[model samples]
Target: MTVNPLVLIAILLTTFTCRAERLFIGILEADSIQSIHYGAAAFSRISDLPLVQEQVQARLAQALLLPAYAGIAASETLKIVQSVDSDAPPAPDNPANVAIIPLTDDGTMIRQAFAAAYARHKSQDAFTLYEAPSDTNRAPCVAVAVADRHLFTSVSRPALTWAWQNRSKFLEAPAQSLPGTFRILVNPQRMADLTGARSAQAARIIDLGRLLRACEALSFSFTLEGAALAVTLRATAKQGSALDALLASWRVPSEPLWHAVPDNAFFMSLGAADRPDLWTPFLGAQRHRLLVPTSGRLPPPAVTGDRLDYVAPTRDGKGLCWVQLLPVKDPAAARAAIRMLADAGCTNAVTFSRLRRRQAGATAIETYTVTLQPPQMAQADKTPADPSLGHILLSLLLKRAVLECAVHNGHCVTVIGPEGAIDEHLPPETFAARPLPLNRRIGGQDPALTPDLSFGGFLCAADLVRHTVTIMPEIKPEQARLLPRGGDGATFGIVHNGRTLTASLRVQSNEIAALQRLNREGRAVLQEVFFQIFANQMMDSKRPAAQ
Candidate 1:
């Protein structure tokens, strides 16, 4: 029997049309899981489209879950989502039929990008990947999905009038340069949207911070500047709109901050602001913390579901960043001390680069604890100092805006160190055999403060201009025993003075013997690497080897 088109519409409405988190299209084992494949009759008409098979499969990418997914368009082929089990349950919710979501905005462009990506996946055996913008009510998107720690992605963006690229490459020695500055902050969400409330009150404060800070920069009024977009958005992670909703439900205060949390909500009354009738939207919004830090280097364990929320700035001056919310508090010291309690269950308190300017005499380390929200913090560390606000913001902006890592060959290599620090200009390690002297200012300031630069699990003191090269090799399971086994298939390694090359190879047919032969040849290459590294170190003796 043929399936009705209305059935498709109902499925679409149930899974694709959701506003909170839409499930655009999906295929499932409608009747059972004893077998998994499409039924012959279910997918007959779809294959007639120019590229339906590829198009339907393209939408399967998980990274596309974000705003970048413009929705799927039907293409050349279709699948018959067939029953999977003989002993199938009477009613199975997972429909095996494929879906096609017509794109409205930038629809054509999205279709083209999808087709091209699918073609790449088929021809190159390249992993599909997507990185959708973290926006809602928007299309022309990108999406990413990772399985077994591997990735598949889909990408789309509106017509590029003149994007970040379009510059000249391969310039002749005498070529005149096009001198220009490119600074664009496109589609930055309101703090409320980006913060996505943990509660109405927290959401309000976060929104206020985002708005006020942006306003302070422009010296423009919110109304006149069109700064705040008032929407009844839920403050969930990503758009992180939960704090607003939670606060609205909790009936938290709306007055200027420093009002203590209500005795009812906060176990410890950290002074907050007064409540208001119109300010009801501030409750119930869940603040999205890096509830889990899944960083690649110091990534919290996949099991440790905690967002590697708190990230130490990438040690060795590489890419690193953290986000937090700061509210005005009573007995300012107590509020500041709030940042110190590791167990303090309040809004985000990590000393963001933006807060540095407001924190003049105060110092906040990026680590987990800083004595913020202290009942009497004004008196403690009355003279402590960290990089100034200007410095902090510049650093924050620099990391976000400047540093970017690109995968080279098989390894991921990224740039670090102060934005434009040159390796050639770094001074030699200032040595002292007896307890290296501390960094001292004009007064009695301790001089122990020092920063570092590193990459690909390597660290150094002086600027090293060379890229931190990484090598990745896919070894089949049986052949993986050749190289030291790593987590799953991942292994951590570095080249030593005697050893020069490192790799994680995959082998499907060969076993350990094949790998041993490969390793034997690698020794010569490793020797060559050591000689080159030794020469570079001799020329610039400041860089200690990365551990």
Candidate 2:
């Protein structure tokens, strides 16, 4: 009896739905396992970006050391899931997570990739041969699984059993919702325990136990949104008074100074007033004690009541600059502080004769220009040292640094850089004509992303790459070609909201193909750079001990 087409379609749909549940149920089972420690699952739709797909395919081929993969066209959708078993004892055979990749073409390419991987292991006396059954249905399926120890005995066996028993599972819907191009979830507590147990001695140095106890979990997701790559990190904090104290110490009032930054700056960071006491820990007690003196000819106070801090470096590295804005609570006090700093050799030349005093509304304003002398060469022997040699050459090449300060309207604006660089770029008219203020730029983009206070900065990738290549002429032409050319610079910032802290970084490019290619190849370099930057910031902001 021939079945009606409509009825057949409905039957197929219901069967597929049931099979999908079974697949998801297996995942749930694995997640519930008492010994199971941590796992991550990611799904990617490469078909959306054909160029990216091709690039990934090329990299995978190289990684697998299989030429066949180079010609293979990856499936439109790919999913990878992995888990670890913490309780498993140290042995050759230990259970771990498996990776499931469904392909559109026959499973030949997958088989080749695994075979090549196995051959490499065999050459090193680490290979284990296992005869495994294959699913030879109309659309063949291939599974490549890995374990903490023995791949075939621990991870592959269990994975194959699941695939065989529920053949329809791989053919049905995915096990979970796919949120982004890449996603990761980590159990901080468990990971800490595992790491600490492996190196008990090292744990004493860093105290991982305390940190793990303070953090509940961490989740990270990355996606391509419009012209930018957006990354979001959510960290759950443990409830307690310690967390409260930490959050309270982070709360401070400040304004962003993006408008004051020069257009030629290769990189810049600006943020509102920071507590000088917060930086004492990183500077240490000895340095702190020396910073503030308690005798005649006293040095300026360690904390200058700076309301805003700005730093930038020029593209050619010829100019390094720092700017501090101090709100003048008392005119006499402000003037005394500046004079004290000047007397302590803060500037090479201080000309009180050129000082200008003005008024903005009822507020008093004073502007001063200070010159910093270049380094002097040490006393030469009886025979005068050549001007082309040593410190003499450096001093001759270096221009005298300059510091310009303008105190007005209850605020003091200080800028340090090459002579006249700051004054020429940051004139009153130009500063006032800037289109968007820092706070508005951040809030207007996404209100939810705004934090109590933030430090904003940008770096031009093309300029950075050009400088790097110039310094390292030995870099291969191919590698240099891979670097991104002209594109929108990358922007980064740190935000704090009560107990939570968020860091955001964004890079945009009109050359999407080149940018994606760079991301695929240089992900490790990018990650290392980001980690260093974040770690340095954290160290720099370390709080002082309460007396």
Candidate 3:
């Protein structure tokens, strides 16, 4: 029997898997990434695009190889392997990362390149090692083995030598390759152990180690198909991890909340929760400007419903607007819940005042606004207020902040936006109105698999960045220029089974190209924002505490 070449390649690629003991392994198909690079450039209409293969080869050579060595044909697949000792994590002194590249040619160019670049070399039966520059104390930074048809490189000489000895095992190991242009496999158990060995300071901010402990493994892949660039992320939970327990607690909705989404919405997230009360405090706190849910000051609102949140651009195109939709068992109870939440929000520090109440069709809509109250003092004692007070006053005068609520079509709608923007997001007369096309696709059926929790959405990356820059003019011109631009937007879907969660995102080719450029050149461009945030935190920490 004869097999097609594409089918044969797929079979071979699918059969390759990493060793069970390895902490992390990444296998990338060079051809696919190269194609994505070329596709992005073409989509962006760039006349001159650098050869990505040459760039890869140059980086691998580490400033040693001359430009001529870059002419060598690149390999089809590249493997990055990192393993950690179960008892002690790998550190800089005992580094355990190695890059394995199969040779398409005899690799004479690589040997010649190293010979021309370095003064010292050591020959071995298995591979030829090239010593680092004389100025550097490190030796045997790279290894080349033409006989074995592979090139191994690592910062640690022992790692490179070990990889050379174990090249056959790595080549023959079974790999679970995802369906994409690139693939990554991570053993989270090992990662969690590694994190435990590190300092515990990060846990105070966000316990990432705890999250990692709840996962068995993770896989990620990226594919450039037709005009779209798709990314797939999959994670498997440990047998009795926290994620497993949470997954068990969730009950899949019999009917998706597609009807709640508006057709014009650019972003929407719809999900079902068996315990609707768990979200009540969060929703209420999000509305109240002063009360923080995590601070344990605000009480949970008595809102009994499954929730969905969406953001839509205002009809006038001046700014963005948002709506929180809750389809509840009792609309009157939801109204009462909102009223209670508003009451809880009003305190000596801030004032939440009722602005208006009116009837629209069969629905009764109410509006409220929040503002900071002036400090308590005698009217005769006139004193200058803080400079920040002017900004608050300006915001109130602009009518850009508002909270409105209504009950329509068996749903309680909470609108948070500018003064007139609430009217635009009022619940329609019917729930089964036209939903976004992306929502229809995500809510559609696939008999192959069942999901406990599912979500779908789309984003116009260019438009979002533009709007952000417009709203916040403080963004530097250089930083704004580094942002993504000019794409047909992207769509994504996510589904979680009892033990696993999978998400896939697809973006236009132009957007993918812009992302690639950003990854390469935008890191330095965006560091200013992080610096400013850190500076602000430092200032806050240094401030004197209240008496």
**Against the true structure, whose lDDT is highest?**
3
Ranking of all predicted structures according to lDDT, beginning with the best and ending with the worst: 3, 2, 1
lDDT on C-alpha atoms for all candidate structures: 0.23, 0.41, 0.54
> Which residue ranges in model 2 land beyond 4 Å of their true spot?
1-97, 100-180, 190-213, 224-226, 241-246, 249-258, 272-320, 326-409, 412-414, 419-433, 438-453, 461-486, 510-547
Candidate 1 per-residue lDDT, tens place, 337-357, comes to 323333334333222121111
lDDT of 2 by residue, 142-210 (tens): 233332211111233443444434334333433222133444444555456556675455443345555
Ranking by TM-score: 3, 2, 1
The candidate maximizing TM-score is 3
In candidate 1, which residue ranges exceed 4 Å CA deviation? 1-547
lDDT of 2 at 215: 54
In model 3, the Cα lDDT at residue 145 comes to 57
Q: In candidate 2, how many Å is residue 501 off?
A: 2.9
